[model samples]
Target: MSYRRLHYHLVWATYRRRPTITRDVERSIHRTLRNKARELKVFVYAIGNVEDHIHLAISILSTIAVAECIRHLKGASSYIVNREHAGIDFAWQTGYGAFTSGDRDKPMVVTYVRNQKRHHGAGTTLSDLERTPDDENEEREE
Candidate 1:
């Protein structure tokens, strides 16, 4: 196959640690993301946001560059939030973390997104979700 589907579990925090990602804001973000994803011809398997950060489980088509797609999502959504919610100022962090997932993991990833509220409430940090022992070992090796 000349092309491969890439599923990305992407996460990013708010700019300057504003912590404005409340439930209502999250709903808006989800809707906005869905619309944009549709326009970009990307499939959004799931999306969720906590008070400080957001997560997206998406399968992007091979034609799209991961970095460029993220930039558009982040930039547009940030502007939408700032415009729609006049009282609140929102901006995304300059960088994000993305992990590739296998096709078989899509269902489980969707379930995880649905439970993000409970997970975050139970003190499961982003690192807690995606960390591997190898990462620590690599850091130590470096």
Candidate 2:
């Protein structure tokens, strides 16, 4: 027998950072993520989103790589969302932010992921979590 716990805070955005995550599609999107996570034997602690991006706090089995989880989740969610909602051109941007969180810090990460909308609305978002690769490039170009 073996024991291991791996928690992660995952974040990603829509294709080209488009604001396509609307109220109506939010349900479908979350459902898709949950379903895919279950199929991958991953546990989703929390999920939150704004118009363009999403956050997921999850614990993945040692057997699965974080990138593989993201690839499947994003691909299935995109497929389901676009299939369910006709004319919605929803796609996830390539690349993601995967930050490891210790078991002791898992609760905080879950809370942060769960409150993404409020955090963004109240201007209390943690910059480190909100930033993406393109953001860095954009900053350098400034």
Candidate 3:
């Protein structure tokens, strides 16, 4: 039998980088992301978020496109958040970052995703994992 394994560390910000992901909605967003991933036959290893952005460690089947998987996760999570939480305008920013991780480094990536808040707080974040497309533009303009 043929074998395949793919994993990615995905990061994206909220629309305009607004702090829409509050404490009350954090759980809902994480749950929605995981549920949506499962529905798409993707495996979500870990998820973490702050007020403005999120990080996910996931494994996708060879048949699934990474962009499509991210689209579904973002769309479904925002939809559920808006529906469940009244008066919240939740939307993701235009672009995202997807970094591939080897099977051996999967555990480290998962740990990083799962401890996003702590990493951010302690200033221990890995820049590459934390970068979004917005950062790319800033770098070019610099």
Candidate 4:
């Protein structure tokens, strides 16, 4: 048997960073994301969102690419949200940020995701959050 442990901190925003995910629809969106994750064989350890963006701590299967998983999750959730809530055209940003972590840091990542509301409430915006090495590299390249 093969052993694999892959954890990712996934971040994505709504189109134009609009605050489309309000309190009234947050639960439905989260539920849809969870359902989509299950279909993709991904394990969602934690998921939380503020107004315009969301954070997910997931353990993805070795067989699935991170981008592919995110595509499905975002696509399905947007479809459901738009369907249920009329007059609201929901869509995700073109790109996403993904950072990989190990078992040792899983607890910390989960806590971070779970406390998103408190963090944002305290004026700790998403951009103010810690940046991964990938983020730094992207910044330099840009």
Candidate 5:
């Protein structure tokens, strides 16, 4: 058997960063994301979100690329949300932030995902969150 351990911290915003994720829809979104992650064979350690964006700590298999994993999770969730909540048009932004972490940092990353509400509520903005090296390249590309 092959052995691999990969963890990633992923974040993405709603289209135009709109506050479409309200209290009534948040639970459904989280549940949909969790179910989608499972279908993709990714282990989701933690997931949390505010109004406009979300954070996820996941362990992905080597068979799937990180981008593809995010694509599946984001695509499916948006589909489910839009279908179930007809009044709300849900769509993810064009790009996402995916940061890899070592096993040693798993707990820290998970904690960050779990307490996203508190962090943002306590005045922590998205810009204040940690960025990966890829963030610079992705930003420049856009």
Candidate 6:
């Protein structure tokens, strides 16, 4: 095979630390993301969200750029949310975190995404996993 397949495990959060994703809003976001991915020929292995963040395990299409894929997912989902909940004031952060996954890690990533709500209940955030030294320094200074 001359070409290789790629999949990304992505996580992103709401704008300004807002927890706008209630049960209904979270479901709407997931559904919108699924439909957008399908339209773009991307395969979604798993998708789930907590109150403030979302996780997605998606197979990246060779023909599509990652930035473009993220644009469609983020933009469309944000629009859908604002439309559904007119007064909810929903928006996503300007940046997202995407990690490349190997075949062996696919199952692990899928399980993580599927259990996002449960994980959130345990008070774990993706940022917690990537806490930087600068973050700690800032925290200590405060």
Give the top-scoring candidate (TM-score): 2
| Residues 14-72 of candidate 3: C-alpha lDDT, one tens digit per residue | 87777889988898998888788888889989999888889999999877798888878
Candidate 4 residue spans exceeding 4 A from truth: 125-142
**Best model number under lDDT:** 2
Candidate 3 Cα outliers beyond 4 Å, as residue runs: 135-142
Q: Rate the local accuracy (lDDT) of all candidates.
A: 0.74, 0.86, 0.84, 0.80, 0.81, 0.78
How good is model 2 by TM-score? 0.92
lDDT measured at residue 58 in model 1 versus the true structure, 0 to 100: 93
TM-score of each model, in listed order: 0.83, 0.92, 0.91, 0.86, 0.86, 0.85
lDDT of 2: 0.86
Clashes of each: 0, 0, 0, 0, 0, 0
Q: How good is model 1 by TM-score?
A: 0.83
Residue 43 error for model 6, in Å?
A: 0.4
Better of 1 and 6 by lDDT: 6
Candidate 1 — what's its lDDT? 0.74
Model 5 gets an lDDT of 0.81
- lDDT for 97 in candidate 2 is 88
RMSD of 4: 5.0
